[model samples]
Target chain A: MSSGETLPAAQAGTVESMDCLVTIAASSGGRRIEISGSGAARFRSAMENKIIQVLDSLGGPGDLSVTVQDNGALDIVLGARVEAAYLRFREAMLR
Target chain B: MRRTMLYLPGNNPNMLLRGHLFGSDGLIFDLEDAVSRSEKDSSRILVREVLRHSGFDGREVTVRINGLDTEYWRDDLAAVVPCRIHGIRVPKVDTPQTIRDLDDALSALESRASVPIGATKVFCLLETALGVWNAYDIATASPRVTAIIPGGEDLAADLRTSRSKEGTELEWIRRMMIVAARAAGVDALDTVFPSVTDEEGLRREALFTKQLGFDGKSVIHPAQIPIIHEIYDPTEAEVEKARKIVAAAREAAARGLGAVSVDGRMVDLPVVRRAEFTLERAGAMTEGGAR
Candidate 1:
């Protein structure tokens, strides 16, 4: 699911795009996330690492897919967006 | 150098316990006016105990004692002056001689208690009409006097005027008190902003006081702390402008010039000094990360 996708469908998979993208999955399998951007590979790795940390802390058993839109955002900001998506997904799951 | 001194009633244990977090530069455990005659003794003892046990964490703590003319003055000083408080706030101070007399008594108490005279300072509350008129003399009465605060309610009572929310009646008094305090080279503090709900009014009054050269304003309620701090804190634009001005001045000085120009405005010595002070204050505020 991308940030544009309001509600996730019954299926879980990874989606990617240039503007904005998101990945969602159920917590049955181990979570894996990877991100790449235009700026630097180091930045992408940092963002991926932070999102994984947040997901691990949340302790949900789901196959995770993360999408990134490289609109010249810093690694911290990319990580923040992923964290926001995770929080929203968790909130929706709770509901 | 108390920039903001909050008045906490002596009998309110909740306020006493939370005094340190009020964001004021100092706290005055008020024993006079706030506490009734019947509760004075107990309140004094409680305040002393609070001072002894409560960890104020370097916040200046002063006890506002009952006036010397009152019978409770002796007992109040005997109970509190020996504690590790910062200063003694004498209310209803009307004359230089009155402050001198209080100073003498405080000196006696300090000597008898074996505490250093310099440790226990004095702050005068100019409450009466006569006190406001003689504020300058009272401010300079003794070396121990650190600040002169106006008591709006009593001063209005002495002047036979009704208290107004706008504080129009006390405008002249406030101006005179600031002038007197500046003339005496001591900190001038404004009276309490009575309305806790009227934060806009409080900010207006705090800015007025800051403009009039008052070091700080006294607050009656905890809710007024953020408004006062907001008024006193340098604005984002001010901080940025100050940084630019300071940088320009430093560059100009390095080039053997006495002045610099920033954004087509001349940055002279005084402007640079003001900018430096603003930066220093901003640095102090952000030392432990943004609050």
Candidate 2:
């Protein structure tokens, strides 16, 4: 609830086939996103765009870190996971 | 038309995306028992997205939400009711009051989502002995109720027994369910046959329930869909007789006669209705035909 304080991390989804696990945490620096796993090689840029779009839609803060470990989940699943993880992170911040 | 409604885990994208291809009459994207507690939130999100983006190939789509007792039920309704699903299958429904409460919640969500109030149907899963006992009341509790299903494992446990291959445990419950569902003018859907590997057992159980007048059975495996449908579908002989009976009844009505006979058997209003139902089940009649 105060500046200089770091909110705990929150995550959603799993590493199962056709799924992805997304984790969000507070960052002191500018926005940071990490993508890996099955989809990263071919869909890295698109996945990044998707995460940014979802975060912007939710009004996510600039000082946040988003990490996605994919398992061949489609774009819809990725967006959903990111939104869920971000919402959970925001909830944790509120607490 | 819901001869088989397949259950797809809400969080499993593989199943969620391809479940309809298995050819069940309907799909039940499950957010309750199939999903873990920790993944509840993410599963809800995933199911919502799937509903929004994926195509179910014209299969009747429904979602099985957590019971009303859980904190997730309301959120579940909020997520799926707006997606324009065919219904929600509610578990642990023990009383008419439970249906009333669920009806209210559904109405609220439907209104908020701009869906017509009462547009979403309710499929009641009678999982407790008390729920089975109150089946008639629960079925008649709301207009939104489309089907009342007697549970397998849960109901057997509630009755302090285990499931038997012969279904000795659920015989009385199945009989009672049929009576109550008919009395309440709702469909009685049988619970899943757990022994998926036992094709013979599945056929036997499907035949039994079909004979008892169940509208359909919940299917856990894709392999079980055709088996249940095979049991529920009207046979060639049955369809032919039903067609003849229906034609005779229609001719009798046209001739201003109050009595009719088919194949030397007296065909009354009930018999005519049954014939028409047979034709309907055979897909010989168009939707809403000759009711």
Candidate 3:
């Protein structure tokens, strides 16, 4: 099984806010990111920054686009969504 | 109020006539993209005549009109804007300016036909890449704009991505569009789940979108209506939980308490708001009972 095949339970305190819809779009070659919503703009930006940091650490040569619909979700939950999307994309590429 | 807005070709009388029984909350008499160029006039006349006589039992009736950039738009507005439809859906909206133009044209048509100024609201379809980028502006362009729906087929084409069964690629756009709608304080609708034969896929996607916080979904077939509603409607467990939360909150308030505890968890203002939304959803699903 590929590393991205598993659905990890959301970790406690992973998301700092629960008022945003987190969407991560990542391909095998590059990534594009967008944060949207009127409330919790700062949190969304911070989450996007962390996601980019993580993706840069992974050193995966692919395009990734992350869009956050901020509804005040916790930071951990936002991280989990980004990880889940990256894993899902990795799994699809493996397939 | 529309849970499932079914699209029917403007020229198809049989579909239009049987629309009420489809179990959709609204019917969109499609004259823009679904009908051919040559049949535009005839389709408008047919839809108008049908609207004049058809008794849809107060189902929200919407007419999708061609963009103002097209030659047929003026005639479409002149013909259908005066009809007793609930709203006019404009296709391929790229900017707030375009929507303003549509509003102007609608006003002219409404006045020319002696209709009320605000009788018909506008529903904007963000089809192209540029349209999606400007979805928020288009949604908030006018007070008459009630809903913003993404056209997945056109969007996919615009993005030059193949439509996948999982729809992962469209996820960002869908979420962004919903955020835009909510920011604008209007309804955000999901595009139709094609593949009428894949009912399971349809249900799964509907549930996913509902979880993503869309107000409703666009459906192509009658069979998809119930599935969409079922996904959208609050579950029994959720309703029960909502009832408990509301009851606890009410009791706490009566006792001069600022908060309530339910299931050993403290419930605050946000929790109450969620419970209220849950109850409202349950009420909408049921006829009169709290269940």
TM-score of each: 0.70, 0.94, 0.72
Docking class of 1: incorrect
Q: What is the TM-score of chain A in candidate 2?
A: 0.92
Query: Model 1 Cα displacement at A76 (Å)?
Result: 50
Off by over 4 Å in 2: A1-7, B284-291
- Off-target runs (Cα >4 Å) in candidate 1 are A1-95, B1-3, B248-257, B288-291
- Largest lDDT belongs to which candidate? 2
The prediction achieving the highest TM-score against the true structure is 2
Native-to-model Cα distance after best TM-score fit, residue B154 in candidate 2, in Å: 1.3
Q: Evaluate candidate 3 and give its CAPRI docking class based on DockQ.
A: incorrect
lDDT of 3 by residue, B150-253 (tens): 88888888898868999987889889998999999999988989899998899888888888888888878888888888878889999999999999999999
Candidate 1: residue B197 Cα off by (Å): 2.0
Candidate structures ordered by TM-score, highest first: 2, 3, 1
The global C-alpha lDDT for each of the candidates, from Candidate 1 onward, is 0.74, 0.92, 0.76
User: Against the correct fold, how does model 1 do in TM-score?
Assistant: 0.70
Error of 1 at B6 (Å): 2.0
Cα RMSD over interface residues, candidate 1: 25.4
